[model samples]
Target: MSLRTRLQGRFQLMAAALVTVVQLPPVLWLCWLTRTPLPALAALGVSWPYLKQLQSPWTTTPRAPSTYVALGWWSACLVFDVLMLPALLAIRAGTPADATWGLAGAVALLLGGDAVLGRPRLRRRTVRIAGLPPELDGYRIGQLSDVHCGPHVPEEKVAGWVSRLNGLGLDLVTVTGDLITHGSSHVEAVARALGGLRAKDGAYVSMGNHDYFTDGEQLVRELERNGLHVLRNRGVVVRRGEARLYVAGVDDTWTSRHDLSRALAARPEGSPTVLLAHDPDLFPQAVERGVELTLSGHTHGGQLGVPGIRRLSLARVITEWTAGLYRRGRSWLYVNRGAGTTGPPVRLGAPPELAVITLRRE
Candidate 1:
């Protein structure tokens, strides 16, 4: 192999090995940290030493390995507050501390609330456009993101989400990429799931990091084949009511290597613009290009974060609005919490979400 190829191969090997090493320590530490006394159970042999050590009746309840693992994670987080406090404190010198408390207040605020409330607090955010074209009134855009389909996929569950989207009665639907976990095998199912959607403008789609890792070109072809507009650095002049709106889509932050110029190239001059990008971090360019609003989803709100405030540090590399609408001067951006999971199946403080953006005249 060439030197560069050999080095890359070695680095990948090291990365895989390091992941295993880094993840093992926590299990070892938690087991060694060793909470409470144990009483022998006869159900399955002598049983694990730490099984009875759990303080929660729920954690100790007989359940599947996944359930035990889930409870074990929550319990470990509860017990390990002292460990996470320092990091939170250090980071908060620049940001608010209550948000840290919000994240760290796992037992009472998160787990307790999740159990008691049984639902997340959602906000219906509305923004008025002063410069919006006169003909466009009640212009609605629906967006879904990060629907990473794979093994153990709740197709029916996802179908429910799709059904909810259809109920919104939106003017248009858009996706912020990561349609499948690895490839296009089940993309047709997703198309069918979202196929029932009736939009005056039609559906638009983009590519994400996972799409590149999977088969991006194939996805674009398939989605286009299924009647979804796959915008790869392209723009379409969509007529909303009597007004004109430029709906543009950029290549994903990681995959298509986005270029706003190419996306806006085909747009009519001086038309109100809305950009559909996979990462909301592309706001500055969209703003510079006179985009009035942008829609995105990639962070999944850390997928393991605190509510109300964001988990930017947890996802350190992505945009700031983990799962909400944010404004930077004249530009507005809505970042979805995402519709699926990656790495782990649990969504703690965050939920899979679909965003409805309604633009009204001033």
Candidate 2:
């Protein structure tokens, strides 16, 4: 293995060890204080799936229902520690045993319900583009990103999303990336589900980091076979009577295939353009190129947040462009919160989203 890969593996191991150290001690102490082995056993049970993930990390696809439950439980415990640990320390007085369980239960139920039942909801936005063609004005495009169709997200769910998108009567549909989580196992299923999507133009897709993780070429073939256009550093023009709208997509930034110049090379001069990039970090570049609208989704809106104030999300620590609309002069970027979960399959404040964006001439 390369030195960088080795270092990353070692770092992952250390991080997993740290998580175990931080999370287990409190649960074990509580179990000891209560003189009950049940909580301790439950903790271990919930942690097993997560531990397996650390062991194999990239290869093990979490498919079991119990695995999801365990993951949810583990996430709840982490949240509990973050919220209660400080309060427990400040009080000095021992917390009632029942209260501890009650709080844990409540956290688990809330987080679990949000993760399991909080389906993607449609969010509508209107963007005014400078010098947009009259025929292209009010062009509605549906966007989906980070669908992550795998163990946590089933084909049926994707089918439902397609049905909903189809009902919207969009002019076009675009999926930003992260179509599959781990392997080729669910690629066909997701492709087939997404194929049901219908629009006046067509559906376009860009690659994401996770898509490259498992047989990206195969996934592309499957998606294309199902009638979705997979844009890899390419642009295409769609016509509405006399007006032309240019839509372009580049491969994911992480995999080193993102060539913005190549993607835009074929663009007709002065044609209003929309760029489909999986990472919103490319927004600056898109702006420099004067791309009218950029659509992306990799943050998953931090997958956790406060409802009204999503800026407080933990995802902010990772990226300044965490979610929602961003504008720089005439260029605009919209970051979808994503339609599925990744690591723990749990969402707190940030719900899954399907965005319907309409373009208006400024």
Candidate 3:
């Protein structure tokens, strides 16, 4: 193998090893201790095939088996974490046998409920923005992001999301990015699905970290081919009657391409501006820059959560603004939970969401 190939091989191995290390303890606890044989088999069955594939050198050919296996493992990990609570309790409390059964029953109930409730659905939110033009009041904007379009994410799911957005009669639609999971192989399919979306103003997209992994430039080209505007540090104006609303999009902050100054430079001085950023962490920066409204969707609200308890999301550890709306003074940010899953095909309390934000003049 070439020197570059060797280095890449080592990196992939390190990553696989790290994932195994992170998952091993919890898997063992749920399986061996709790006497949950299914989770243990699932953990090994899914991971072993993918681990074997990783041992092979990287190639252009799609590793569908490995990819699907990895997704199964990720889903298994989610179930294991949920069962851990009862599994631990069963071990420490008397009558371990009964507790083991309880663990299985709880897991089944939770998983079944999650599968039904966690399906991607449309959620409408009204944001009253100060200084919004009177003519622009009650304007609707659709936001979708973090669509990890790969083997696990069905094309029909993408089509359904597009259809829902089109049916909303939205004035504007924004996709914050990560359209595909890893590579540009599925770009055409994603673009085709999104091409069905309709809006009065236009459909615009910003780059995400995953987009960068899949030849960001090519992805941009494909999206533009489907009539979606790929804004990379650029601004556009949407005229509503006599009012001019500015819309700007910066590249993915995770890739260090986010430039608020360049993005805002094209906007007219007094126009109400809406900024599109993939990561919500830039909310403070946008706030400082006097951006009226910002839209984002990177954290997916931990993908797993406890309903009615917002703090239950693991995303809190990374971002204070995990999901929903947050305001700092006159600036507002709405982080969509996203319309798709990433690592796993499953979701818990944090269901896949398509945010329809209606802007009302305050």
Candidate number achieving the greatest lDDT relative to the actual structure: 2
> lDDT tens string, model 1, 112-160?
3232112223335565676788676678888878877654344565576
> For each candidate, what is the lDDT?
0.64, 0.82, 0.78
Name the best candidate (by TM-score): 2
Error of 1 at 231 (Å): 1.1
- In the range 1-362, model 2's lDDT, one tens digit per residue, is 86436534764675465457446766876788899988778777776756666553346454677666766666656566545654554445456765566566555545643544367878999999988889988999999999998887899998999999999999999999999876778889999999888999999999998787677899999999999999999999999998888899999787588999999998998899999999999999999999999999999887766655768876786688988999999999999999997766777667889999999989
Sorted on TM-score, best first, the list reads 2, 3, 1
lDDT: worst 10-residue window of model 1: 38-47
RMSD of each: 9.2, 4.6, 4.7
Q: Residue 84 lDDT in model 3? A: 69
Candidate 3 residue lDDT tens string, 51-93 = 6654532222365766666765666665666676767777676
Give candidate 3 regions above 4 Å deviation: 1-26, 29-46, 51-77, 84-118
Task: Name the TM-score of candidate 1.
Answer: 0.72
Clash totals, every prediction: 0, 0, 0
Q: Which candidate do you rate higher for TM-score, 1 or 2? A: 2
Candidate 2: residue 34 Cα off by (Å): 3.0
Q: Deviation in angstroms for 195 in model 2?
A: 1.1
List the candidates ranked by lDDT, beginning with the highest: 2, 3, 1
